[model samples]
Target: DVKVTQSSRYLVKRTGEKVFLECVQDMDHENMFWYRQDPGLGLRLIYFSYDVKMKEKGDIPEGYSVSREKKERFSLILESASTNQTSMYLCASSLVSFVMNTEAFFGQGTRLTVV
Candidate 1:
């Protein structure tokens, strides 16, 4: 079955520390994404990569960055963790699509707490 796997289910970090959240996909998908979810802000995209070694900054990329060194793996990095950054982080993988109709598979998610 197709799936996205997160290296950690949860994380806790002190303010100003650097944090890394890893993701891996079993399916050989060409597109991968990282998002941060908050109550009102909804699922805001942090970063996405369409191909290996190629990345695009998403809606809210100010404090986050992504690495797509391999086709099946994507990593999200918090430059300097802050309490405001505490949220549920999600990783997703999908096939490249020309048409609008396409499906994305998501990881279970990693909840990060910045204190």
Candidate 2:
């Protein structure tokens, strides 16, 4: 089975602090993604990487950046934490494909709280 691991299950940060969230997948998948889930707003993608050293901005990339220097690891960096940025962050991995049939396997999510 494919597994994705997030660095933290929960995190507390102060406003304006820089935060780093890490994710690793064991399946050697080609696609990795980071998303933030808010109430009612659903999951909003923050970043994604399809290959090493390659990254792409997703739906909500402001104040955030990503790194993918290895095939199995992806990192999400919050330049400056804010109260509004407090949400459940999810890391996912999937096999690269042109069809959307492949489901994204997710980690247990990191619940971040900014005060």
How many clashing pairs in candidate 2? Answer: 0
What is candidate 1's lDDT per residue for 21-114, written digit by digit as tens? 9999998999999999999988999999999999999999998888889999999999899999999999999989737577999999999999
**Superposed model 2: Cα runs more than 4 Å off:** 98-101
- What is the TM-score of each predicted model, taking all chains together? 0.95, 0.95
Q: What is the C-alpha RMSD of each candidate to the true structure, in Å?
A: 1.2, 1.2
lDDT of each: 0.93, 0.94
Off by over 4 Å in 1: 98-101
Clashing pairs in 1: none
